[model samples]
Target: MQNPAAATSASEFAELPATASHGPLRIEYRWVNETACDAPIAVFLHEGLGSISMWRDWPQALCERLGMRGLVYSRPGYGLSTPRPHDVKWPVDFMTAQARDILPALLDALDIDLPERRSMWLIGHSDGGSITLLYAALHPDALAGAVAIAPHVFVEDISVESIAQTKQLYETTDLRAKLGRYHADVDSAFYGWNDIWLNPAFRDWTITSELAPIRVPLLAVQGHDDNYGTMAQIDTIADCVPHAELVKLDGCGHSPHRDAPQALNEAIAAFVSKQK
Candidate 1:
């Protein structure tokens, strides 16, 4: 509703195939409220290279555990959504675009009006985590709370170097093949994200200043063994928002949902249940 032009950017795919129409992109989302009990909505935001398929069934389990309806979707150029323009690379303000424009448009197309007492809870991982922070900061009242796992608040040399390694793996190994299993068009999703982060302008990306505006309760988690980000990311978040809590997982890497499902799920369930 906010940016009609951005919302309709993917309109050509509207007549394409099987997918949920969120704006012009086809978002794959699963809704399960079998309990018929009134509960809050939990929006699950995937990692940079993640999609609904990559999330597997974790979202469903979390929703059932907490008795909340869940919303999960792939952004444009990912999963079942439309492919991105090949020549277009992600800009330095990519996160800002997602927060100020794309996310709101998606919510509008979904026909969801913000509730008063308990707003939608966000569970975001990695890039989704950063975008969640951005969204929470901009529309603090729209969220009940949020849980971010291994979110990046600032870009570091380690991340860029690691991403470079990943690019090599994508070309030399079966990494792209593995991604193919989860994405309908793995290249679109992969390149759209990978190239943006690797862009020269992306090296200085930081959302800490924006995060200070977040008024909702937050729970941030990071793996001790996470190769993607440093503890400073969550540390900065807690520093910025006094109400934020940080959890450090041991023996875990980037994908905490898969590596430590029980712990992650339990923590999230507890956090969402306690939301007021």
Candidate 2:
């Protein structure tokens, strides 16, 4: 059953100043139940190819059920935010950059005082999931807990194969057009992610060692039929994070929120409730 408290209160933009290496960016973001000022905040990190609009109402629904405020935003190059330059290629450590630099900058710009208040909760999907893990690892004390949905801890052969197939689809099918609806510059969003993941050098990327330092509660969810990765991804998270919980959903693939939204929402709400 879906929660009836699902309601988005506002959508806005945060203008981020240019950093040493990158230009200024306008981030499109939305807030759910902003009036719940005393409640813990839950930030939603979209997938690699996703945008603020792409998340639809899932963040609102989840925040409503948890009685928490919600923050959903489009990363640079995705949605209404600043688009990636055409000639620029993302580095192999792009996700790390997001976790280390971009996310913190955004939070600071938004006046989110992480250190003073309780650490915020994070709900991340796909690439966002990996970013969430990296952020939690890098700043173990800045997060209350996290939920990683279909996150990649390490690159797998299947991941490369599926990403390659997506590249073909983007080239040959209406995938580009469909994605364009979500991004101001579709190629920036697509190639930025696709190019890096398919790069040979990225094959060695892994956050397994980084996971050992994470001390917060973590719930790792994955689909049994996920084409992009196997159960090893979440299983490894369990092995590294002490008492990390795992949820394996049957009849789902790559995206549990899309495939099993109700179950995902209920599970997350229950897990978060326990933390409180």
Candidate 3:
């Protein structure tokens, strides 16, 4: 296996000479260099504990296959981006901060203002899927379409139980040590997300009501054997968005890109191509 740190390099990006904001919390982003194409720019959102580096070669492969520009970046506390602040756990309004605040701010900071000139196509996984739904709902007109893998729309008993199990693994296993390889500060990313989700107040978390407002064409997908969430998660998305398409992959697991790459790629490519 390759060293995770050795995998960190700007050349991996379609656009080099990385552009970033070194503000209170440094955020790095890149815009593909080629002239804009017909397909919406594919913005890959990582999973709950994932960062851009953790995505490995998946985004690059997807962009090439779909013939679209790719935008992949670390959230506030993941990858090589700035660490989360020292004083706080994830706020109750964390999703809002990601959708209403961080995303738009990143776009503005990058000067990607005109959605009509070049719209976006969101491909999100896990918690990133939730954030995508929230964004599409709040900014319905901004995207051409969206695809979410193993998305969670509401807190479920299964989800809470799974997360509790993850907490135990974090404490007793090498999970934390492994996570340290991907994040600049493991605690910033881990605790910020873990502590909040496991908090009692978060049991009532639900984005289904907020997601109903999204008018874009949505493709909700899930693995048959996903360890983290249930099929009901993506099912809820399709139910809410009448036009949403649902695809269930057999013999697959939590990480579709990892467990079912061929199927995931074909589905996304088809959805994005048809949107043109």
The number of the candidate with the highest TM-score is 2
Q: List the global CA lDDT of all models.
A: 0.77, 0.87, 0.78
lDDT tens digits by residue: candidate 1, 1-276: 111222112212222222342235555554544342356777888898987778777877888888776667777777776667687777788777777777676676666676622467888999999988998998887888888999999998878889989999998999999999878888888898889889988888888888888878899999888888888889999999989988888888888898999988888777766764
lDDT of 1: 0.77
lDDT of 3 by residue, 1-276 (tens): 011132124623212222342234467554442333344577888888999878888887887788776778888878777678867778776876688777776666555666531377888999888888888898888887888888888888877788889889988999999999988888888888888888999988888778788888889889999878888998888788989998899999989999999999998888877877
Checking candidate 1 for backbone clashes, the offending pairs are none
Regions more than 4 Å wrong, model 1: 1-24, 33-37, 116-118
Model 2: number of clashes?
0
TM-score of each: 0.88, 0.94, 0.88
Whichever of 1 and 2 has more lDDT, that candidate is 2
Q: Which residue pairs of candidate 2 clash?
A: none
Candidate rank order under TM-score: 2, 1, 3
